[model samples]
Target: MAAFSPELTVIYATIRTLDDQHPQATAVLVGGGRVLAVGSREEMAALAPRAHVLDHRDLILTPGLAEAHIHLVAYGFSLAELNLHGARSVSEVQARVAQRTMNTPPGTWLRGGGFLLSELGLDEYPAAAVLDEVSPHHPVLLFSRDLHLGWANSLALRLAGIRPDTPDPVGGRIVRPLGTLLESASELVTRVMPVPSEADFLAAAKAGVEDLAGRGYVSAHTMAFEEPEAPRALQTLAARGDLPLRIWACLPHERLEQARELGLACSPGSLFQWGGVKFFADGALGSRTAWLHGPGFAGGSGTGMPLDSPDLIRERGAEALRLGLTPVTHAIGDRANTEVLEVYEALRPLADEKGIRLRIEHAQHLRPEDIPRFRGLTASVQPIHLQADGPMIRELLPHRVDTSYAFRSLKAAGAVLAFGSDAPVAPPEYRANFAAALTRRDDEGQPIAPAEALTEEEILWAHTRGPALAAGWEDEGIIRPGARAAFTLWDRIGGNARALVL
Candidate 1:
């Protein structure tokens, strides 16, 4: 037996179906939670005489939006933690931790993230003693918003057994004299902490989903880092018919074999599907670990860190393609992007052979010459980060500023631009992304790249079809008659819209 919609429900008035054939169609028929038919209002009504009708007299109807990248569990965890994204100085950060500690138990771990080194106004990493002053009894661990670095007080460092003599861990650094941990180094302290229980995972997952929905997202690509129980929690919600948004999950590379054993393949559909094999190619911009090219940041001492070797990426990428998984890797700086692109170039034939699309997350900063090479690849980018990164770009890579976030250049090169928030890294606010994409203005009101600014229609396309293509979601992200009925209704672009669950 199949489901039929409540008879006679026709949505009318100024419908924009995002269909090439009927670009400005004015009506859509809904049944069984899918777009049954789309035509002129008179044509649709005659087909179902007694159908209920919705008049969207003043709204723009478009396909439901999708977030191309985010860490769902981390975003949920951040909701309850102290945020330090804009701490102007070490004192400001201490003030926040002090306030948080006051309300926390005497010996409880003070857990929070979202600090930026540049915002801290420190030339060097702050000393742990600064944090120990207010959080003497409690163990305090504050992670950089990018999650690539961690700032910890003396107590927290001691608890994690990190000392001046502690050598740098493989592929990570413990900032000396006792204060910060970089990349894999942060894992030491994190691993020692108590793991959140199943109940915690469920709560965080629920909150994260609700937050996304509130921000007008109809779906998301959750890059896995959460515990095994996390995806199960989402499955539970979906199975009980409680999920309001669709999820496309990417398991960490470590679990690739397990996923393959379970018969998981890229673009495998079940409403919610396993979309890709996620991997980290390098660290983040904030932590100065973003792998950079030869003339690395004007005054910076190092040229950033190389996370996963190119050989490793190539090997894993090939394996993922063989198993029908999209290879999505995080690459930030020019060097990182360049190296990963090289890996992709090598894997392109195989990817094409397997009918897979190669996805590069955070194609943030790129060497102009390399932009064209991204043609036909998925540039899963975050426009919202530009707001915060604009100033950094000026100070760090001034010469390349024009080419950074080169949306226009990349698009012209034939690359698919899939915009996203990289949530938890920044808040998952689609409105912010829209504003940033259209305006190209930094927090200081400076234009990072005026020429790269996209129009409302282009941004909408990137948010919808770009991601759809990246994920290989054929039936979604369009408003044609044969498309799924999922859509959002807004009076205008960049505003909160009511998601009509068809």
Candidate 2:
């Protein structure tokens, strides 16, 4: 164990240890940043007479929450960016962009996201003219809520040299009218945008960590949807002992070789560690890019786009496992999930040999046959997304509606369900996740998959223990002797919660 404060602290509360041997406790003795004992208040007091006592007899204490997936630095920077999450129309989006533009200089770039095309009541891809009308002098780029589609104004398109005839890049597409860039095409504008300084990256990393910590999370698994500097900033924080949340980070598969060259393996023990390699098998549903099976989207929206090939995932995944890293893939559509499962099937033997769990992010839509295939895999899902995606699934994917966001089914299939917010795409609000999972209701108050609803205890486990297991952190996500001392105090399960700062 690493050095920690020598002083002993005993916390008295209604403790849910989540341990079979000692399922309940009234007091916990903590030292060296770990649990030393768990029992009744009198027993703990007798064991550590000189320990400082924290009385919280009315509150419920459980293992600390973990955000199973997030784009940490991007979410931090988004705190200051324009937000269009609830915008219901083109006019509303225009007004928000115009408001931000009026407060900024003419040539500056304005960036933000969180709008759904379906919610905006748009039948086709939105044109650049919609935003150009609001901020003609300034460049603007807004992403779809799923981050799979980019809505760029004429100025921003011109800056990226995207014209009407520009060819779509592999694994991405550029919509007509030169307004929307899908998948890898979004990189066109983003690559040309001004890069943040080292200080800016560090600050954003700090903000994201602090925000989650404040929300009662003791840890997070940051997905690799950010610049390389993002993780570097987090590492700097870890080195300086400024990070409050333990972070398990992923590198884009493109960096796998470089990681191998640097001799980087799964090095745990510190507050921050690299543990997974992230890959996208397909785009997102809201963007109409989910790689679906035959008969695809109901209205001829066609089967979704596939990003990484199965061959690449298989070959590279084997290499990643050899280095002690998990192979994490993003699979949203049934076809995407099917294909990824095929790849994982090939990698399973190697993964088992290495003792690493293969993870699938957003196993949102699935075929009944594929449900059984998820056994022993980590289904890192976001129930909060169900609130917004419910109607979309009904409209575009009616055939798969029964299995969409199938949390209960996934759990019953022996898949470890790790809940998360996919922050920046959505806020990292655990309450939203709890409500969405328990209710199975969408924004329209319609049930997407009522049979998929999970209980509050199950949701709690997904948020805490499930994520810890996915990240291979055996000492976290449970309140027991020899476990991390971090925990969350709740007024009630599925109610207000705050981290117990020890």
Stretches off by above 4 angstroms in model 2 are: 1-6
Cα RMSD, each candidate: 2.2, 2.0
Query: For residues 1-502, could you state the per-residue lDDT of candidate 1 as single tens digits?
Result: 2333356468885666656887777788887667888878877777776778898967878888888888887788789988887788888988999999888888788888777777777667777888988889998888888888888888888888998999999989998778889998988888887789888888888888888777677888888866677788787777777778888888888788787788777555465777788878888878888899978876955788998789988988888898888889999999999999999999999999987789999988988899999988999999999988888889888877998888988899999999888878888888888889899998789999899999888888888778888888777788876677778788787787767657
* Model 1 lDDT, residue 236, Cα: 75
Q: Can you list the residue pairs that collide in candidate 2? A: none
TM-score of each: 0.96, 0.98
Show where candidate 1 strays beyond 4 Å: 1-8
> By how many angstroms RMSD does model 1 differ from the true structure?
2.2
Error of 2 at 100 (Å): 0.6
Worst 10 residues of 1 by lDDT: 1-10
